[model samples]
Target: MTNILIADDDIHVLNLIDIHLTEQGYKVFKAYNGIEALEILNKELCSLAVVDVMMPFMDGYTLTKEIRNLFNIPVILLTAKNQIEDKERGFHAGTDDYLVKPFEPKELSFRIKALLRRYDNNPDEYIVRIGNTIINKKSYEVKVGKRTILLPLKEFELLYFLMSKPMQVFSRDHLIDQIWGLDYEGDERTVDVHIKRLRERFSKLTDHFQIKTVRGVGYSLEVNRE
Candidate 1:
């Protein structure tokens, strides 16, 4: 379940991408604009993203540039503008790859797989190990030591986001936005609830607890130095 985000203003484009990517066995998240894309990007750590150049409020260039600064995630631009200057501009904006409009879905999928293999931390699988816990980001599975722990869908999602960037502080507001999304009518308390659950479960198994409370700041994963 490799996560992939597709940001396009056209409804048809979004539908097409969602259908094709999902059929190809990739977890595809779709957004109609850059703002929506940014919101989703904050929540899930995707292996790659396919973004349209022309979008309202932020556009592909600005969104991709911001994403690059935040995470070393790969971005592929889909643009009607196929000019050399446009491609150069996209590269300047930190785009890893680009595809002009009116392309095959299979080609896009192949390009995405190639980029992930070349750039992602785990090309074969999207898993991150912390302490003795194994996180399969694709399937949203969590295994502590040799035993597997079943987390509720939302809780599993929350834990994955927190673990993606170990030791990086995330404010309650930020966590809420990321886990719940901008449209979710949930408050900051939701973050606390999930954090409490995650800690309790992890504390029972591994001596090395990863989630850390930064007091007023919020929560972060504790990096084991030894």
Candidate 2:
């Protein structure tokens, strides 16, 4: 069954969409805030998400960005903000579609169907982003806003592994095993060199994320969300 998530602080709007999607045979997961929506997503394999722009804890744009980095599901921004800049921001945040409030349920259904069909045939991207920085696992390319960058294979792999689990600490040994493989003869200092290069490359370029050393532990990617 197709699963859809509807996150809105307004109860009436939330229930209304739930009823419409349920009637259309979609298993609906409803959330009143961005945090709840993400919690549900972590537990359920939702096909798509309908997110409102304003909410407690996290806003729709940040939520969409998170979904883009962590999950492959499509996102539709649902909000009352209909300005041109607002739509542009939504797209830049990685939303697949945008439906303003005061929308027809049928229109939403149609959009949902279109996105699901599109994603089903879409190729694997394995893309992860923090703020303005994006790293593509498939291409080994790092992009910050409009500029595209190619990192050394090891550095790219290291940054990708760290960012893939934001804020999660990994010791050098675990990182070596994960990034360099268990058979690698290189010592853990090699990890430090690659990490140093990655840091130098992005230090002045972007502030979207940071690789922080965990004192006695190792390093972790800390995403600075807006």
Candidate 3:
């Protein structure tokens, strides 16, 4: 059974989400604040987390960052702030999805299912090697030479997809569909954000392989021959 954590300052909101998620056959953990959420996460293995933005002690953005650093679970932020900037901030903080407050419970369930399905569907167990970088899809591990670095779920997926098909140009739309899913309502710029983070994360490792932009087309992974 999959365990899900729901954290919100509002008791009504927490209860609502808990009831719905539990009814959907998920084991639910409820927390009223980000601090409590962290405590639950420390003790329990949650498959996914639904976090509210404005919480006591720790905000959702900070909690999401902590979760990303410590856990590999997917996160969906729930907040009343629907501004593009707010959504971008949530994503930048390492959330896989964002849902505005007063959203339909059914929609929330749908997003949860989609995210879980995507996470569980590993392309293959085969290890991919490019230059000094080694990508192990099975273990969700990336090693640059002897050093191992962690990446957020979406970023890792993007890297795996690009590396899986080196030198193959992928359009932004294609990547967004493949990675974020066709039902993704977020801005297409999300792809650019993940790509930028990937470049920055691996910049110090090696230069033999690079992710290149094809101008108006999109991006591709280029492996240089030694």
Inter-residue clash pairs, candidate 1: none
Residue-level lDDT of model 2, residues 35-142, one tens digit each, is 898778756668899999999999999889888865677899998978999999999999999998899999999999999988777654377656678788988888
* Count: clashes, candidate 1: 0
Per-residue accuracy of model 1 over 1-226 as CA lDDT, tens digit each: 8999999999998998899989989998999998888778656767788989999987999888766654557899999977999999999999999999899988998999898888755542466656567678677779887898778988888887776776678999888788778888867888888888888888768764478889889998764523
Model 3 accuracy (lDDT, Cα): 0.85
Which candidate do you rate higher for lDDT, 1 or 2?
2
Instruction: Identify the superior model by lDDT, candidate 1 or candidate 3.
Output: 3
Any idea how many clashes model 2 has? 0
Q: Which clashing pairs does model 2 show?
A: none
Candidate 1, 30: how far from true, in Å? 0.6
Consecutive 10-residue window with the lowest summed lDDT within model 3: 122-131
Worst window of 10 by summed lDDT in candidate 2: 122-131
User: TM-score winner among the candidates?
Assistant: 2
Q: Give the TM-score of candidate 1.
A: 0.58
User: How well is each residue in 96-195 modelled by candidate 3, as lDDT tens digits?
Assistant: 9999988999999999999898777745324666667878777788988789877788898899888767667889999999999999999879999999
lDDT, candidates in the order shown: 0.81, 0.86, 0.85
Give the candidates in order of TM-score, highest first.
Answer: 2, 1, 3
TM-score of each: 0.58, 0.62, 0.58
Pairs with backbone N, CA or C atoms under 3 Å apart (clashes), candidate 3: none
